[model samples]
Target: MADIEVFVFAVEAELEAMDRERVGVHRRGRKPDLALRRRLVGLVWTLTFGGMQWRVAGWLSGIPFTTLHSAFARWARLGLWRRLGQRLALDWRLACGDEVLPSAVVVDSRSLRSAPSAWARGIDGGKLIKGVKALAVCDKHGSLLDLELYPANTDDRAGALPLLSRLAALGFQGDLLGDSGFKGAPFATAALAHDIHVSVSPGGTRDGCFLPSGIRWVVERLFAWLSRYRRLNIVYDRAPDLFAAHIWIAMISIISRRLVAQTHT
Candidate 1:
């Protein structure tokens, strides 16, 4: 089998066993055509690693650019990629001792330049932070718990708590560390509900001095890992769904690699 086949197999098995909801079925059937799946995998991997345009991804995958783009949007909206992420996170939890809570969980967001079109406007038109942002949360052990993407214009504070709430539901409770942008009552309230303490890096304030900014480095490293895939390094997707899939798939890839690393070690 091809590498994509292997990836899909591993992902499919995990999702089949773990996901509470199923992806919407295509009229063609539940399992996508093998050729189509391979192409989708190739496109995602290429974007993940190459950071190329869909036209370029088309050339690489030998599928039409539009076809490649459509598949990505479809799968992303269906939450197939999110299911993969959840499975990877669960696998990491299983591999690590379930009783050992991480000493720290890091939170951060980074932006990427998105497609320039009418649709990419407003909250969709990623903000001024340089590009669209992928807000990520990860434990000190480098296991990613949750991630969210917003137009660069979206403030980090606006989207951080929802992911935190999801993480708390998933059993992540510990001191939460982030940059200065994350300091606020909403964050504090959410963290309090989960019994998690908040720490923020102080750029030049007394509160900054007390915040555990050093520990926030772990989340930065998590983003670094996700950025290793070229497609994610740039926001090349035309739709938010496609863009989110790139993030989700890159995350799954990172966790899968980590799982392998642990087994070897």
Candidate 2:
């Protein structure tokens, strides 16, 4: 794992660039006694490596449980995790001599079983799991670009529309490689509007193993990487936004580590 300080620094830089007001820094108050750096470092550590409860995390970090929870909630609500992940991914790509913007993206989804108390969940008939579906888009090198969480009942094409819309909204004009579930005229037509060509991978063999497909594997690798984070291996968050934030946080950690390694080399 990379040092927590690197993740904290990258996030602070992003927050400053995106305007600190979003985190309520400009609000009229006595101001927090704890430094934002320490709080953020603790928060990232909890999200990335600590699977314990927020209270336990706070105890370990020497911050009040409520304070840590409230700060995390505020940042999640403000979409800070997602923004920071994007910024770090871009920086890593640039540092590795890749294009600032990807011309191609791979899309995939994973169905994770939810906790008994989780609110937003549905049965994935294909996977036969009662949970939510995590749809993600990644560049050729497996860097996360965007993610969406929806009910498992949602078909791939239906669940994928929002992610596609987001990519288009971000002015992403290129090709998208996906699995057989994303094939069809409707998706193709939708992607055409954004000047994005949708190419679905070939079907698997009768034994249930997919034939080798070069481009589409990157998204699968991303899912594998995300699964390493205990927080992401299962759906524990009550709200979809918070779940998405955790995914972003995990990616932030991954990208920041890559950036740090690149800097050293």
Best prediction by lDDT: 2
Model 2 residue runs over 4 Å out of place are 20-26, 29-37
TM-score for candidate 1, residues paired by index = 0.76
lDDT of 1 at 161: 67
Q: After superposition, how far is residue 138 of candidate 2 from its true place, in Å?
A: 0.3
lDDT of candidate 1 over 8-93, digit per residue (tens): 55655544453334445353335557667655765676676667777877886678888877767766776778777776776787
Whole-model lDDT per candidate? 0.68, 0.80
Runs in model 1 deviating more than 4 A are 1-9, 12-22, 28-31, 98-104, 118-129, 203-214, 261-265
Cα miss at 259, model 1 (Å)?
2.3
Query: How well is each residue in 1-265 modelled by candidate 2, as lDDT tens digits?
Result: 3467777777767666656454554245654444765675557556656567777777777778787777677778877888788777777778878888889899988999998766688999977999999999999889998988898999989988878778887678999988898999999998898789998886467788866587888888898888888888778877888788889888888888887777677
Q: Which ten residues in a row have the lowest lDDT in candidate 2?
A: 25-34
For residue 245, give model 1's deviation from the true position in Å. Answer: 1.2
